[model samples]
Target chain A: MNETLNFSEHRMGKAIVLTLQGRFDAAIALPVKNRIRSLAEDGSRRIVVDLGKVSFVDSSGLGALVAALRYVSKDGGDVRLANMTVKIQQVFTLIRLDKVFKVYPDLESAVDSFEEY
Target chain B: MPGRQLEYSARFGPNLDNLILGADLVARFREETKVNIKTGDQIELAVGEALSNAINHAQAVGDDAIGLTMTVEDGMLTITVDDNGIGFLPDEVPQPNFKEHPSHGYGVFIIYEVMDSVSYDSQNGINTLTMKKRLEE
Candidate 1:
């Protein structure tokens, strides 16, 4: 299995939208986490992580997202999740992370949510 | 033990690269068994979690290999991951406080969610985790 993780980013108003592709597991979680950390350090606080292309996520991935959430929330900003597969969503629910992050069915809605504040 | 049985197993180095290779082997196993995508994905996730724990948490003194065994029988698939490392009490694992945004400790829980049954054993510097799931008809 080719286990490479790559992400694409774009700006939706003030929110930095990142679309992550490939497995979100221990082997690749650190790089993804570092990217999010860099974004936060660059003053991009409102972030939306799109998981539509992500096929799987383990604890490490979950932890990375949680870390991203914490980083962005430090200054009254937030990190939101979008387009999680049912299986991936189940993991979030199992770990009770579903309650911790704002989840939307699509990226547009997620970006719209930030505009509401 | 209820239906026709097929077994495939292998051992590999206890590292992330080997874990990825093992996952490929598992994908082939699923294809050979005609497992549906959803159920196969579950198996992949469960076994992946088990192997991740073995690779990340189970540390050996020297170069100990992680062992994997998979058996499909009677509409059920079973996988075992063994590591020669220090073991911990499964029951003592704390539920992660996602609200607190903790960065570790969710591997085993994901296994429990994806597998039908999961159990662990440890003795003589070896920790073994076994997980089972019912395959789709």
Candidate 2:
């Protein structure tokens, strides 16, 4: 298994799906935040982050997602999360972030939700 | 016979990359000790937060070494993270308002929520954060 955090992006209808793999923590938070910022600035109003393969996420990772939401919100866009593992879900629930971000069980649902955005 | 006690300890340089190394150590500890995956996940999360906080704080002061120790005994798991950086009062950190959805200040909060109890102390320029969780039989 790839130990380092990595991501890839692809267009799906009006939404941009960014799939993240490996651990998401302080080490890669800045770059991930920057990538999300660039995506929002580049006119992608609807962004979906796929965390299916992400094995871990700490506060720094959550902060990056929150920052992404704030950045896109400024552009009238929204950032959604998809496919969080049970552990990731637990962290989000513990911090009550589950109520802040629109989370979907799968990437397709996340991408599809953008139709209303 | 009394339950076997397990212990592990190590020190790492002040670097964010050590976060991963610390986590891997926890994973190995969990595997060797036969900790349940669910509890192990929480332990890893809490320890990761502690290590991250220490490493970041240590970087600000200087490249100091961070110490980590984990011990399991009597149905309890204890973790202690030590650093040479300036430490703050744990009680002083306000509980993050989930309503505000703030982008920062969630590290300590996460650690507190995951661990059963957390405490902080500083002595002679060394700061230590101790976290504990109850383990299931």
Candidate 3:
């Protein structure tokens, strides 16, 4: 019910790690969108969204994530999702988003996918 | 309204908690009404969408309770979600298309697609969204 979303920057060259917590509902969907927009605007193209801590994601929540993926990739950066739950993962698989988004088992590998970051 | 009526009601939080309870209500109604699987899923998703819409847009606080009611009459299921909060124009709310927008906007769209009938009425501080789905095999 009470989940927190956190943004962390690892100055490991060109990669940014964003950690999402709590529930991703319509209430906070816009905020997530704005955050991703800002990050992409700042030139942090290689982004890895850490969903290991995200507990719930409905259709709206998934929308925000999908939007983030599209926005971040537009400027030569890629977004990868990591540590998704079975319920959330099933949703992605159901909609075939798993194929569209790069999913990783852990943040380390997801971040390391930055072409030598 | 038919000669017979079956009803169930519950109050839940203004967040995702209401969503779970809403699903439960629909399941119970399906079991009692003995509706077909396709009809049951339609009713279940329609009611669920209405409850989610109430909780997401209307309720101000997390603990604020939304009342859900399901009516089965004339071989059809009617669900009503009532919230003691702000109301808006059902016409103004944009329709959600999963192919175009896989987001919260689709809740009402899903309701309309699955339900046989749908309407929203607001008066004296109560928002009532009623949806109906027919029994089919």
**Top candidate when judged by DockQ against the true structure:** 2
Judged by DockQ cut-offs, the docking class of candidate 3 is incorrect
Off by over 4 Å in 1: B61-64, B98-101
- Per-residue lDDT for A1-117 in model 2, tens only? 227699989999789999999999988888999999999888888999999999889999989999889989997899999999898999888888878899999988899898877
Could you say which candidate leads in lDDT? 2
Per-residue CA lDDT of candidate 1, range A9-113, in tens? 999976899999877887887788889889988988899999998877877888898887787778877889999888788778778886789999999999999
Q: Per TM-score, what order, best first?
A: 2, 1, 3
Per-residue lDDT tens digits of candidate 2, residues B29-83?
8878777888889898898888888887655354446989998888788899998
For candidate 2, give the DockQ.
0.67
Two-way lDDT contest, 1 vs 3, winner:
1
If scored against the real structure, what TM-score would every candidate get? Answer: 0.89, 0.94, 0.58
Q: Which pairs, if any, clash in model 2?
A: none
Clashing pairs in 3: A3-A22
- Cα lDDT tens digits, model 3, B40-92, are 65565556557767877885443555888877677666778888788877888
The local distance difference test score of each candidate is 0.81, 0.86, 0.69
Which lDDT value does model 1 have at A65?
89
Stretch of 10 with least lDDT, candidate 1 chain A: A1-10
DockQ of each: 0.54, 0.67, 0.14
Model 1 per-residue lDDT tens digits across residues B53-101: 7788777444447888898889788888888888767778877556665
- Taken in order, the candidates have interface RMSDs of 2.0, 1.9, 5.5
